[model samples]
Target: MTELPPKPSRDELTERAARVRLLAFDVDGVLTDGGLYYGDGGEVMKRFDVKDGHGLVMARLAGLRTAILTARSSSIVEVRGRELGLAAVLQGRKNKAAGFRELLSQLEVSPEECAYMGDDVNDLGPLGMAGLSACPADAAAEVRQSVHYVARCRGGHGAARELVELCLRASGRWEATVQHMRDPDALQAVKL
Candidate 1:
């Protein structure tokens, strides 16, 4: 049998993580509570964490890009992504790696400049390619073992916030990013 290439070690991951300019995540388990509800008319629904929304907003404020990829389509996710001004929103993507590559190419960014957070098998491919891969605390054993960081929170319960904070702090942009958000005069200050 042919030998496969070895995966990047944790130290290499940490060094490369400082260069990340984009942070993307898988939907469902990564963004939502992983619970789907079908109403009487068969309309589907999923709950997104508001703190996760704030995290994405903070990442955007730091001049880092943010996006979402979902294997199954959801109008709720679409609306939330648009509301958050995420740079890319990919849906119905069976091959997450393909979606990730397409988004990176579309954004004109390198994989070494990106991070990914995921929670399941479907998310593994993209996670594997990111400079710093993270997973929710409750992610599958294989997924947690494969990632560089395992969030303290579970999915849809501030997990995104935990990862976003980790990435921002790792890059030394978290304090600036939060201050920018807290100051309503920040944008106006830029104009003066």
Candidate 2:
């Protein structure tokens, strides 16, 4: 794990989180452990966190749009996004900030209503532009410095889930989300 800077106050975190309508992520170091594994057949192999996927589901249930913006294109990510029902999954994007802007336009949202999580310098542009910026504990030094929140958990180890939980809690929907998960039928009855 990397050394983390001081975290913002809970009030501040919740304040920023409350304004978020869309939450986007960077795929590599944010969702995975940043390990690139290539098979003999040239197949790209990546490990995804089930917890992160669940978090995305919960985010959707809470009425927040979720997206994935990655520089590297991968079929695995595409499948994962589909499984989680993400609003967008943009791969092979050289300019993540530009991609995020396009996503905002498509969703009819503003930067002030977007939250982004990333783990490298490549993510700085989106982080700077987002209303709430977050990163995992093991994120790059510069990324840690730039983010508003640095999760205690490392990447690929429930870090994304942690961010999602923060958003739910800040929006005063965590408990209800938990309850909804317990009673799937009841969740269907209530409108998100």
Candidate 3:
């Protein structure tokens, strides 16, 4: 296994993550391993990590919004976004920076309040604009170097989940989120 690069200091990550209200991601390499599985009908199938989907749910429960921005549009993406209850899903956007800006505007959030994760060069614009930037272990060299965090896990594995846990922990919501995950009813009772 290739050794992962060192990440930013915990204090620095926590500070940036604390200010994050929205978490955005790229779909290709960041979420689906960048592989296009085409069938006989020229339709593409993308595989998503169940853990990553749950991570989004955890973030939402912790009071953070989630979104997806991709250069390609696909019905599968829409299905996954709806299943995860993502706050925003913007697809077929070649200029990711512009798309990210539009999303921020539509969501009424500032760049400083967002955390973005991507795995390729197309993501650089928004990655630079986000308060906290992250990439998967197998991300492009430029992307890995430019990001604030690089996961040990590869894309379509657990990279997204790792970032989500980092943000939740840094923001002091990990414990509660874990408690709820372990026993939702128990946590609700405690809240009551």
* Local distance difference test, candidate 3: 0.89
Q: Output the better candidate (1/3) by lDDT.
A: 3
Name the runs in model 1 displaced over 4 angstroms.
1-14, 184-192
State the local distance difference test value for candidate 1.
0.84
| Cα displacement (Å) at residue 52, model 2 | 0.7
lDDT of 1 by residue, 99-164 (tens): 999989989988878889999988889988987788899898778878878889999999988878
lDDT of 3 by residue, 39-131 (tens): 999999998988888888889888899999999999999988988878999999999999999999999999999999999999999998999
Shift in Å, residue 69, candidate 1: 1.0
Model 1: residue 28 alpha-carbon error in angstroms: 0.4
Candidate 2 similarity to native, TM-score: 0.91
Q: Give all candidates' CA lDDT scores.
A: 0.84, 0.88, 0.89
> Least lDDT summed over 10 consecutive residues: which range in candidate 1?
183-192
Question: Candidate 2's residue-wise lDDT over 78-119, tens digit each?
Answer: 988888889999999899888888888888889988989999
Off by over 4 Å in 3: 1-7, 184-192
